[model samples]
Target: MGWLSMPLSSMHPHSTPKAYLDAQLTYERVIDEPAEAEGEGGPLPSRKGLRVIASSCLRNKVYYAAVAPTTDGVDGPVFAVVCLVRWNPRAKDGYVFAYKDMDETAGPNEAECPERILALLSPTENHSALQWRRRCIRNLARPTAKLEDGMRIRFASPIKFTDGYEGQEFFVRKRGRKTALAISEHGSARYRVTNMARMAFSVVPQTKVHRTVF
Candidate 1:
């Protein structure tokens, strides 16, 4: 997590792959909403200055990385967007990536930025490299154990997410040789059970899952 000199404009829709723009926009809008008050710390601050520089969708969750200037409206060393309520806003389901350093920077004297997220802001790496890596891993992965309806699997672990899954274990609703569908009580999203590339996300009845994962 060193100096990332890439201009923020590089993340705009015209500059990013069309496949990613919509999800990034959605995440940006989600973070822009006023934070809900939960407890002692009260509500988190509004992030009007935070700019999402990269995003990728993996199964049911979408991950994003963002940056903000250290000082109010000026430039220089920046803070990374790491303290998000990691869940589907509409569903109110919670997924936790418990980082002790929720907000950190790359500059000296500041807490070190989380390297996994910081990689999304790397200048040497191609913008879409992480997305491509995830696609490849998802497509090639084979279940080491045969799956059956009602069997619970920690499938999210094999993908090597920077932050490991911190929610209920996924129970198989249905399974096939190549892909399967998982369900959690709090969230049920539309999914394409046959194909990974055509996965979709929409709030569905808790009993229905329209998408699948390999």
Candidate 2:
């Protein structure tokens, strides 16, 4: 963790990404219908703030993040779409990313943030430049582990995330060398994964998830 004073924008007046990044590490969540009482389905989720995961921005466009599709939303594998966006009368799925603006669709979040992380380094040290480069490399590299159907992996990081859960994992359904489709019985939405997010993951039996999820 380091202090980085990025160019001040009315968009992000703060000088460091750590404050926002750290806030995303954990979040309060609300899923499904906006009800105030328990019913036949289950307990109702609160209107409190949600834990933001990944984010990216396109000019003034902004976005929050989410993990899964709501019970009434569409289902399937997709890279992303505004229809999957959330946190308002707009996003019917769930409150994932909170977009500040729109480009005929949704806004962006941290996914597109530049790699120039302002780490704490001495301006006078030549080695500092090398160290920063190395850290960025490690942050951007894709996961090397192989993925196949039926395997489980944790959502470590995403190269391109349209939909995701911050503190959840998924079971692989379909996969490629650099990407895979994953499903979750818990709080996770069925989202795609890139090699970067596949790092340092854990495996769980499908049956175990089934028995425990309910």
Which candidate's TM-score is highest? 2
- lDDT by residue (tens digit), candidate 2, 1-214: 1222222242153322333333433344455665556767566553434232333332222222222222323322211211112222222443323322221112222232233322221132335334434543564665456566667666443233343333445666643444444455433335543333324565655554345665
lDDT of 1 by residue, 1-214 (tens): 3222222244344332223333333322223445477767665544333445543333323333444332233333332433222222122233222111133221122212233545544332433444443443453453334445554444322322223434334555554444444545334432322233232222222354678878
TM of each candidate vs. truth: 0.27, 0.32
lDDT of 1 at 90: 28
For model 1, the superposed segments whose C-alpha errors exceed 4 Å read 1-50, 56-64, 68-75, 86-101, 105-117, 120-151, 154-169, 173-178, 182-214
Q: Please list the C-alpha lDDT of all candidates, in the order they appear.
A: 0.35, 0.36
Lowest summed lDDT window (length 10), candidate 2: 76-85
| Each candidate: RMSD | 17.7, 22.2
Q: Which ranges of candidate 2 are over 4 A from the true structure? A: 1-126, 138-143, 156-167, 175-178, 185-189, 205-214
C-alpha lDDT of residue 19 in model 1: 34
Give lDDT: candidate 1, residue 49: 33
